[model samples]
Target: MVLGSAVPRRRLLLVALLAAVVLVVAGGVVATRLVGGPRTDRGATPVLTPGPSTPASPSTTPSPPPPPPGADITGPLNLLLVGVDTRVSVPGWEPHADAVLVLHVPRGLGRAYLFSLPRDLVVDIPAFPKAGYRGGRTKLTHAMSYGSRVPGRPKQPDTAQGYELLRSTVSGYTGLRIDAGAVLTFNGFDRLVDSLGGVDIYVDQRVVSRHRQPDGRHRASAPGGYTGPQMVYEKGRRHLTGWQALDYARQRYIPGGDYSRQRHQQQLIRALARKILDQGLARDPDQVQQVVDALGDTLVYAGGGRRLVEFAYALGGLPADRFVLVGLPGSSVGSGGSYRGEQLTTVGRRFLTELRAGRADAYLTKHPTLKVKT
Candidate 1:
C-alpha cells in the first residue's frame, strides 16, 4: 500500500513538471481568449476594456514594452467569466451556472491571473431586477435564475446586466473593475476541453456520481441512463477528459465543499494556462485553429480579434514565475438561509478596498507564497 501510494505521488509530480511543456504549445489558443473574443464573422461583440496604456507592473518587473506609438494607457483589467451548464435537453435550465471565475490581468503583468469564486457565496445580488420585489440581496447564482425568465429582446436580468451588477457588487466588495466578460455553456466547455485534449488535475479522494433528470429541453442522456458518477481518485495527478474533467473541477459537495471546488477550478485554469504557454502554439497555426474550432457555438466573446491577439502576444512575453493567483478574502460566514438553508459567506470589505486601489501587490508582497489547494 505504501509503495502504491508513493507511485501515484511520483506520477503526479512528473505531470506537474510537464506542465510547462504543455503551456508553450497551447499558449496561442488559450492566450487569445485571455483578452480577445472569437472570429468577427461569428457575430461576437467586441470587448471594450481599455488596452494596456502604461505597464502597471512597475514593481515586479520593468513595464512591458510600451504599447505601439499611439498605444492607449489602460490600467489593470478584470474579467468575470462564467460557465453555465445549459444543454438543449435541459431547457428552463434555471440556474445556468456551473462555475464562476474572476480573471485579473494587470497592465504589464503580462500573464493572465484567475480566481474562482464559490457560487455558494451568499451575498447581495445588487441591481438584481427583483431588487424592488425581493430585497435583491440573495445567493449570487440566482442572478441567472432571475434573468433567464425575464421577457424581451433585452433580457431583463440577462447575463450582461447580471454581470454588470455582479461586477459592481464584487468591485464594491473587492475594489476592482471588471472590464470585459464571456460566457460558455456546458456544451461549449466540453468541446473546449476536448479540443485542448483535456486538462490534468490532482484528485485527493473518492467521488460517486448521482443521476440528475435532464430538464427535457436540453440534450438527452445516453440510453444507459445519464447518471453522473461521483469521481473518486487517489491523491495524485492524472489527465481528465470532458465530463470527467468537468465534474472533477466542479465537485462542490466534497468534504471541503465549495471552497475545495473553487480551488480546484483555479488550479485547472492555471494548469491550462501554463500548458498553453509551454506548448508553443504560436508556431502551430493548425493546432491553434483546431482549438478555436472546438469553441464553436459555445463561445460568446465580448470583443474583436486583433486587440485580443495583441494582448495574447503580450501575455506570452511574460515569465511564468511572476504570475500569481489569489482569492477573495474571508471564508464561510453566516448560516441558515433559503435554498436548503444554505449558509452564506462574504470576503472582507477592507481587503477588497485595498485591491481596488491597485495595490493587490501589496497584500501579495506581504504573503509572497500563498498556495491554494483544492
Candidate 2:
C-alpha cells in the first residue's frame, strides 16, 4: 500500500525510513513505536544497558557507504532483534524469546548479516539481582520469562525487565556488545501487518499451526495442548493477511521445528520490508504522515544509545539485496531426545567466533551451509 503524498520530501523520507529500519530486523515488521509515544503501543521498549564489552576484534566493518546527506552513525553496528511469543490470549502465559536474532551491519554498512539464535539452546543464565532469583541452566527462551518476574510480586510479568536479562544472556553468549535492542510482541506484529495491508511470504515447507484453527480463531485448549482443525500452509508463495502471516511463522511442530520456524520468521521479516520498499513511500511525501500515523501505536523501538529516528536516517540507505540471512541450528543431536534445551552446533559456535573477529564474511563463504537460502 502506498502512502499519501503532500508532506515535504524530508518528512516523507523520515517516516518511510521507520518502516525500512524496523522491518530490516529479525521479524521484519517488529520493533518499537518508531518515535516517542506512550507505552500503550503494546510494543515493548527495552533500554540497552552497557551490556557487554565489545570484543577486541579488528575494526574492519566497512563504513556502510555514506547514507543520505544527514546520516551520522556508522561502523560495525550490532543490534539484538527479539520477537517475543506473548500469548496474551491466555491469562497467565509469560512471554518467551520466540525469535532471537543478531543483526550485524559490517563496517561498510553496504551489507548486513542477520544471525538467528535458537530459542531452546541451553545456556547458563546469570543471576539478575532485580528478579531476586539465582540463575540456572535452562532453555535460552526462559531468560525472558525469568527476567520479567516482578521483584516482590513473582506473579506479575514485566517485559522490560525480562528484556534486560535476555539482553544480558544474549550478549554473554555471542560475546558482542549490543549497540541497541528491540522486543516486539506477536500481537503487535499482527497489527503491523494489518497496518501495511497484509504481507506476502513464500512458504518453504508445509506447516500445520498448533495454535490457530482454520477459521483463524484459536483452537480449543486441552490438557495436552490445543486440539481441533489446524490451519495449514502449503508450500509456495502466498499473499497473507495478518493472522495468516503470523500463524505461518509461529509454527514449530514441523520437520525443522523452531529452527525451521526461524527461517520462516526471517523470511516474513524480509517480505514485510519488501512490501514497504515496493510501495516507493521513500520517494513520495503526500500520505507519508498517514502511514506513520497508522504505525504510530504499533511499534516501540528503543535505541541502545541513539534515538530511534537517528537510526532511521543511518539505515535509510541499506540496499534490499544487502540483507543476508544466516540460520544456525540450535541443536546438533538432541531433537529426537527429551528436551532439556538446545545447544548450538560446533559450526554455529565457530561462526560466532569468526563474527567477533570480523571474519564473518569469510567464515560464511567457507561454510555455505550456514547461509539459509531465501
Error of 2 at 219 (Å): 2.4
Per-residue lDDT tens digits of candidate 2, residues 267-366?
Answer: 8777665555555444332243345454554545445444454454455456767778888855643556755767888899999999889998899999
What lDDT is obtained when candidate 2 is compared to the true structure?
0.69
Best by TM-score: 2
* Clash number for candidate 2: 20
Per-residue lDDT of model 1, residues 193-214, tens digit only: 5556777866656543332212
Number of the predicted model whose lDDT against the real structure is largest: 2
lDDT of each: 0.47, 0.69
- What residue runs in model 2 are displaced by over 4 Å at the alpha carbon? 1-70, 88-93, 278-304, 332-338
